[model samples]
Target: MTNVSRWAAMLALLFATAAWGGLFHAGKLVLNNVDPFWFTVVRYTGASLLLCGILMLQGKVRWELLREHWRRLASLGLMGYGMFGILVFIGLSYSVPSHGAVIMATMPITTLLMRWVFERQRPQLWAWCVVALAIFGVSLVSGVWRSSTGAGHSTAFGDLIAFVGTVGWIMYTRGQASVSKLSVIEYTTFTAILALPGLFAFAVVATLLGYANRPDPADLIAAIPPILYIVVVGTVLAALAFNKGVRTLGAVHGIVFINLVPVSALLISAAKGSVPNGSEMIGTLLIIVALSIQARKMGLGAKAAK
Candidate 1:
């Protein structure tokens, strides 16, 4: 690929990251008006349809691949979409968002370990350094350096659940390593589609069990704008860009960009009238430097992989 194409792909991933960041606000809005489980069901359903439309437009839909790999695709859907969502949601109840946020900020390091255990790929000294800086940056941004009182919350349990959720996401990223026959679009769409039944089943069960805070139809209707933005921009667009970046940049390198999430969320939050702070600024710069190193090497790595 030309340098131009590489840059374009990087920008696309950045946009996808930004979309995900926007989801922080969007999710907050929807939670006020809809059941979290119900919201996730709608979000995934919409994402699947949006992806199907995109694949059709690009003439890149690969439904036959599903016939050959339904099991793996469904498993990926369970890892990437299911466990992360369910576990993280439950975890937030037991712990503060700060705790979950810190754990999530460690995604690159977690994914690095997944790469080692699953792919048997050992990262070099530089890779380790990058991940270390990334963790420090994420810690700073996520307020890991700040002290907190337990305030009667089970932060330990919550943090552990969040860690497990992080593992689920790491596995999802690892899914890309072996599924080379499918295009990024095909992989994202099929997995998302196949995962729907399971997600739907969970939502239905929760609703039937009279789960607390379940949203009514009117609440779902009221949350339309944020829901649409989340399903379309956050899930569909972000998934496409992220999968493409992973394909181009390699899983470990591309997954490192998740460090950018806190940065984008902070900036976007600031734009929506939240004040920015010094720690956030420093952390954002740290991520920028770390990702610059990663991207500089990504070009060489991609060329080598080819």
Candidate 2:
């Protein structure tokens, strides 16, 4: 890529990371008035419709390719959108948003391990050190080093669920690595379509069990802003931006920027009277540094592989 194009890609990646960061706070706000499953159903449904409309408008709809990859796409939808979304939301209910955000920063290390175990790819020693640092950082951020009472309610459980969700995300990314031909819009549309059934199933269960919270008119109105933000900016725009960044700067380069999400989430929360303690900040910094080193090493390995 040319310098200008690379710079633009980097900027897009940064914006995408920021949008993802804001999702922690936005999701927390939305959960105040909606159940996790219902929130996920609405968010994914809205995002699906918006992406479908955009694809139709751009004359880029490809039903044939989607059918060809239907199984993989469906699995991606179920794992990444359906299960991952619901787990993180439920996990957040038990943990601090900042804690969930920081714990998720370990995704890069998880991705590396997945590649090693499943794809038989060995990473460098530096990468292993980075992964160790990331684990320690997450432990610190989650207060796993401290007494149970020192942490908030169910914080440990929440962090564990978040770790599972991170693993699911890594699996989804690995699945997508096999999809070289699909356009971003095509892949997104397929996943969105596949997510609908899973989301609807959860929604139905919630309603049937009377677990669904009926939003008052004001609550309904309150959900509008965050819902729109998530559907439009968080899902569609961020997906496109990240894809573009990966195309220009590569996935490792783009994903290393995601370490910024925790910092951004912390800042947003602090601005809203949810400031993290000094330990959280230190742990966040350590994870960021570790992930950056890990990503750089991964990029070099990819070059060597090529």
Runs in model 2 with CA error above 4 Å?
1-5, 150-154, 206-219, 247-253, 299-306
Query: How high is the CA lDDT of each candidate model?
Result: 0.73, 0.78
RMSD of each: 3.8, 2.5
- Residue 50's lDDT within candidate 1 is 86
Off by over 4 Å in 1: 59-61, 89-105, 123-163, 205-213, 276-306
- Backbone atom clashes (below 3 Å) for every candidate: 0, 0
Clashing pairs in 2: none
Stretch of 10 with least lDDT, candidate 1 = 146-155
- TM-score, every prediction: 0.80, 0.89
Model 1, range 1-306, lDDT digits (tens) per residue?
678867777887777767766765677677777665777778898888888888899975667889999999999987888888667655555544334444565677676666687679988788788888866765565455655654332256655676688787778878877788999888998889988999888888987888735677899899999998988887888888988887876676667677666666666667777764576567657766776676667668867977
Task: Give the alpha carbon lDDT tens digit for every residue of 1-306 in model 2.
Answer: 689998999898888878888887788788888878888888888888888898899885778888898888888878878777888888887778788778667777777777688779887788888988888888878777666763342367888887787676555555665676887777777887887897888778887898766456677578898888888998789877876776667654666677878988898889999778777788888999998787667668677997
Q: How much is 18 displaced in model 2, in angstroms? A: 0.7
